[model samples]
Target: MNEQERMTRRRFLKACGLGLAGLSLSGYMTYLFGGTSVKDVLKSTLGGTGADGFRALENFRINSVEPTPNVQLADYRLTVDGLVANPVTWSFAELKHALTEVEQVSDFHCVEGWGIKNVRWTGVKMRELIQQVRPMQTATHVTFYSLGGVYTESLSLAEAMEEETLLAYGIYGKDLPAPQGYPLRAIIPRMFGYKGAKWVYRIEFTDHQHLGYWERYGYNVDGVTAR
Candidate 1:
C-alpha cells in the first residue's frame, strides 16, 4: 500500500476501535493526527482505573490486528546479517534449540489504545540470539524483518538488550495465531506494541537505526508509554 493508504488504514482502525466502545473517533483523531495522546483520553474513559489509565489487558481473546506471513515450517530460516562480525543463518528447527526456551508473563500494549496483561510468551531471548552470533562492536542497531517480506522494525542495540525482550513462538500455551505473527513474534514489555513486531525472520545489525513500516508512516518512532 502507498503511504496515504497506510495512514488511512491506521485511522480507520483507530476509529473502529473507538467506535466499537462508544468512544469518540474525532477525539482519537486528535490523538493520532494531532498532539493529543490516547493515554490522556483513556484516563477519562477508564475513570482512573489503573496507573496512567492503561487498561490492564486481562483476556486471551485474540485482540491483535497484525497480519501473518506465509511460511512453511520446513522452509523457515532466519538470517542474522549486515554489520555483524559473524553472520549466522538458523532454520526453524535450530531456533527451537538456540536457547533454553523460557516462558514469561508480560503486559502487551498496542498503540491504537488496547492492551493485554500477564501475557505468557515462549521463545528465545533476542540477546541470546545476538550473543550466539556476536555482533561486531561497530553494530549500533538491529533491524527485524518479517516473513511477509513487508513488515519491518528497528531498535538500537541498547534497546534490544533490555530485559524481557523475546522472540516468541507461543502465546498462552499455544502456537502464536497466524494473524498475530505466528512462527515468531516480538514481545517487548514496556514499549507500545508496534515496536514489538511480529513474523520477524531476519535480524540485520547496522550502525544506523532505520524506521519501520509504521514509523515511516507517522507512528511514534519511540513507542514508549507511561509505566
Candidate 2:
C-alpha cells in the first residue's frame, strides 16, 4: 500500500482500538489472528444488556475516529446507476414507500472475531432494488458507497441478489443510531461485517469488481466469514 493509504488504515485501526494495522495478518490470516485480540478487548469491556440481545456496545464494532456525518433525511438521496437499464435516485421517504421492507434476524460476524447474534434488521432486499434498476447483461458486480464518501464495498451480482442482502434502515425495532450509520447500511449476512458498507448512499452496477476500502489494505476482497 502507498504511504497515504497506510496512514489512513492506521487511523482506522486506531479508531477501532484494534491496534492490528502493523500486523501482517492480510487476507484470511486477518481473521485467524486478529479475531483473538478483538475478542479479548470485547470481553474486557462488557456491561449491561442492550437491545437485540447485545451487551453494551456490542451491537456493532465502534469506529470512534470519524465523527458521524449529519445526514438530513429531507435531503438524503440514494442513487442507483452504472451498468443498468434504469438509473434512478430516491429520497429516503420515497425509497421506503416504494420498496417493500422486510425484517430478518441474522448473526453479524466480524473478521476481528467479535460478533453479534440474532440482530433484528429491517430494510429492503437488495434483489428488489436490482429488479427495479435492471442491471445490464454486462453488469456482474454491485458496489455500495457510503455517504461519508470514503468507504465503498462490492459484491458479485449473484451475491447482491442473495436473500440475506439487505439495505437496512432500522435495527432492534428503532431507527439506526448515528454510530450505526443512521439512515442506511448494507447487511450481507454471509460475509464479515466489513462487507456491509454503512451509511450507504449509492449503488452502482459494474462490469468489474470494485475493491473496497479494506480490500486495498489486503483484507479479503470477498470478506466472507471464515466460519
Candidate 3:
C-alpha cells in the first residue's frame, strides 16, 4: 500500500477499541490470507492493549512517522563494526537471506506491568550473528543503535549471546509493523520492552559497559525478572 493509505489505516487502528485480543486475531487472519496489504497487516499486528497504551504514551502519534537514517530498509544498513576483525555493512535483504529463520512463541512482559499474551516471532538467533562476527577478546558488551539519533541499548556479551534473543523480522506470523520496528527489532525474552529496542539499526561490539537511552533516563539496565 502507498504511504497515505498506510497512514489512514494507522489512524483508524489508533482510534479503534479492539484492544490486544482483537488485534491478535486480526494479525492471525492477515497471516493466513496471502493477499493482505501492508496496512492491513499493521492494523492487525499493532492491535493490542500494550500497543494502544504505548501509542497513548506517545500521545497517539505513530512513532515510525519520522524517518530515521537508521530505520529505512533501502537506506538501512546494519553495521557490524567496532571490535570485529571484518567490519561489515549489511543490507536488509542481505541480512534476511544470510541468517536462518527461527520461530518463537513466548510471553512478552513490559516493565510497566502490562504483558501481552503469548505471541510467535520469526527471526534469526542473535548468537548465530555473534558467532559470525567473532568478537575479539576485549569485546565485553553489545550496544544497539537505532536510526534515530542516540537511541541506544546494550547487552553484556553473555546476554547478547542468548539463544532466545533474536533480531526479529516478523511478529505474530507476518512482517512486523513499522511502529513495532519493521525490517528489524531486538527481542530479548523475559526483559522489559525497552530492553527489546525498537527501530533497531546497528549493532556495535563494545568493550566497555554503557547505559542506553532509557537506562540513562532511570529505567533498569539489567532487566532481569524475578519469578
Candidate 4:
C-alpha cells in the first residue's frame, strides 16, 4: 500500500479500536524461537504479501468479523415497518415460497482493502419487499437491523430500491451460512461490506438517514467502492 492508503487504513483501524498498525505482536513471538520474532506469521493471516504460498482472500465468500448469530430458519421472523402503509412480518417459509428466487454474481468489497469477487447470491429483490409494505412518500431511507445492536445500517431509498439490491437468503447455491447471515441479509453489490448488514432481520423505512455502526465510527457514509 502507498503512504496515503496506509494512513487511511490506520485511521480506520484506530476508529474501529483494532489499531493493528505498528503494534506488531512480534514481541510475543521473540521468546518462541531464539528471540527471532514471527512477524511474517501475522502478515500471512491478516495482510499477507502476494507471495506464491500465502492466500489473501477467498472467492465467492461472505464474511463478517463480528460475532455470528445462531439462527434457525423455522423460528426466524423478518419485520418490515416504519413509514409504510402496510407493515408486515415475514416468516422464513413465506419469503422462500412466495418470492421467485434470483441468482446474481457480484463482487463483495471491504473497506479494509480486501475484496471477494463473483459471489453467487440468491434472493428476492429489495424492491419487492418495499413494494409489499408500500413505503410512504415521506420515506427517504431504509434502516436494516441485524443480530448485534451495533450491526444497524441504512441506505437511501433510491439505493435500496435498485434492481441489484437484494435480501439474500442463499449464497454459493446453498442456504446462507450463519457466519454470513443465515435466514436473511441485505446484499447491496455496490457498497462496502458494512452496508451489507449480516444476520439482518428487520427493515424500517424512515425519513432521515441513520449512521451505520461503522459510519458512526470513521468509515464514509457514502461507502461507494470502485466498480
Candidate 5:
C-alpha cells in the first residue's frame, strides 16, 4: 500500500482504539482494506479484561486480521549484520542459550494515549546481542525489520545499548502468541509502541538512522513517550 493509504488505515485503527489493543502487532491491512465491518473486527479481536479494566496482550484474545506468518521455532533465524566485526545468525534455541536472559515489568505506551502497565517481558538485552557482533565505530544506528517483511524500525546504537532495550521473545512467562509477533520482537520501554517493532527478524547496524514504517509517514522519529 502507498504511504497515504497506510496512514489512513492507521488513523482508522487508532480511532477504533485497536492501535493499542495489539492490532499494532501486525498491520491490520487485510481486514481494514477488505471492507470488514468495524464491529466485526472488534468483536473478534478485542475480548479481554485485565486489572482495572485495562486490556493487555496476555489477556487479550488475539484474532489476526492478516494471514499470520507461520514461524516454526526450529526454522526461525534472526540475523544480525552490517558494519559489524562479526555478522551472526541465531536460531531460536541458540539465542536463548547464548544470551543473558532477563525479565522486567515495564509499561507499553502507545501514541494513541492508551497504555498497558506492569507488563512482564522476557528477553535478552539488546546490548548483549550488540556485544556478540561488535559493531564498528561508524555504525551509529540499527534498524530492525519484521518477519512480515513490511514493518521496520530504527534506534540509535546508544539507545539500543540501554539496559531496558530488549529483543523479547516471550511475555507474561509464556512464548509470544502468533499474533503478538511469535518468535521475536523488540521492546523499547522508553519509546512509544511503534518504536518497539513487532515480529522482528533482522537487525542491521548502519551509519545513518533509517526511518521506521510509521515514521516514514510523519510519526516522530524519536518516539519517546511523554510519560
Candidate 6:
C-alpha cells in the first residue's frame, strides 16, 4: 500500500481499537508480508473514508440502551415556552395529528464525520411551529432539549425556517427508532447532525445566540462541513 493509504488504515484501526495482531494471520500475512493491497482491507474495515466513516463511528454504539416504550401518550408532553407570546404544551398524539406532515429527502451531515442515507423524514415544519408560537421580532435562535439530556441543538431563525427542515417523527416509512430519536427529532438539511436534536422534549425561543451542549465544547454550532 502507498504511504497515505497505510496512514489512513492505521488511523482507522486505531479508532476501531484493533491492533495488527488482531487481524487474521492470512489477511495480515498476505497484506503485510506478501504486500497484498491494503485498499481492500481499508475499505472493508473503515467502510468509507473521511466524514462518512467518522459519522458512522460516532453513531456506532453496540450496547446502547433502547428507549422505554411510550405507553401513555396523554402523559407525554412537549413544552414550547420561553420568549414566545403563545407558549404552549402539546401531547404526543396532539403533535402527531395536529400538525401538517411534510416529507423531506435530504443529506444528514455531521461535523464529527459521516452523513445520513438520503433520509425521508415526515413531521411538522419548523416554520409552522414558529407561526404557532409567533416568535417576537427580537428572537434570533431556538434551543432544543431532548428527553434524556443526551442530545441538544440550536439553529438561527433563518436556518430553522428552511422548507427542508422538520421536527421528524418518522424515518423512511416507520416510526423513528429509539436510539435514533424516538417521539420526535429535528431534521436540518443544511446543518450537521449536531443541529438535528433527537428525542426533543422542549423548545425555547431566545433573542441571543446560545451555545448548545456540543457547541460548548468545540463542535461548530452551524455545522457546515468542509467540502
**Which candidate has the highest TM-score of all?**
2
* Candidate 3 C-alpha lDDT tens digits along 1-227: 99999999998897685576689886677655321356534654566345432332232123332364434568877888888776678888888787789999776766655555456788998898988888999999988877676577889989988878999988777787777777788989878777877677778898997798777768778876522
**C-alpha lDDT of all candidate models, in order:** 0.75, 0.82, 0.73, 0.76, 0.79, 0.72
Over 4 Å off, model 6: 1-72
Worst 10 residues of 2 by lDDT: 47-56
* Model 5 score (lDDT): 0.79
Output the better candidate (1/3) by lDDT: 1
- Residue 182 in candidate 5 has what lDDT? 84
lDDT by residue (tens digit), candidate 4, 115-150:
655678889998887888899999999999997665
Q: Which pairs of residues clash in candidate 3, taking residues 3 or more apart in a chain or in different chains?
A: 20-48, 20-49, 70-147
Question: In angstroms, how far off is 47's CA in candidate 4?
Answer: 22
Better TM-score candidate (1, 6): 1
TM-score-superior candidate, 4 or 5: 5
Q: Specify the poorest-scoring 10-residue window by lDDT in model 6.
A: 56-65
Model 4, residue pairs in steric clash: none
Name model 4 segments beyond 4 Å from true.
1-65, 225-227
Among all candidates shown, the one with the greatest lDDT: 2
Each model's TM-score, in the order given? 0.70, 0.76, 0.68, 0.71, 0.73, 0.68
lDDT tens digits by residue: candidate 2, 102-184: 99999888887777667888999999999999999999999999887888899999999999999999988888888888799
Backbone Cα, N, C clashes tallied per candidate: 2, 1, 3, 0, 0, 2
Candidate 1 deviant stretches above 4 angstroms: 1-67, 225-227
Q: What tens-digit string does per-residue lDDT give for candidate 6 at 32-76?
A: 322213553455465545554333333433222234445344576
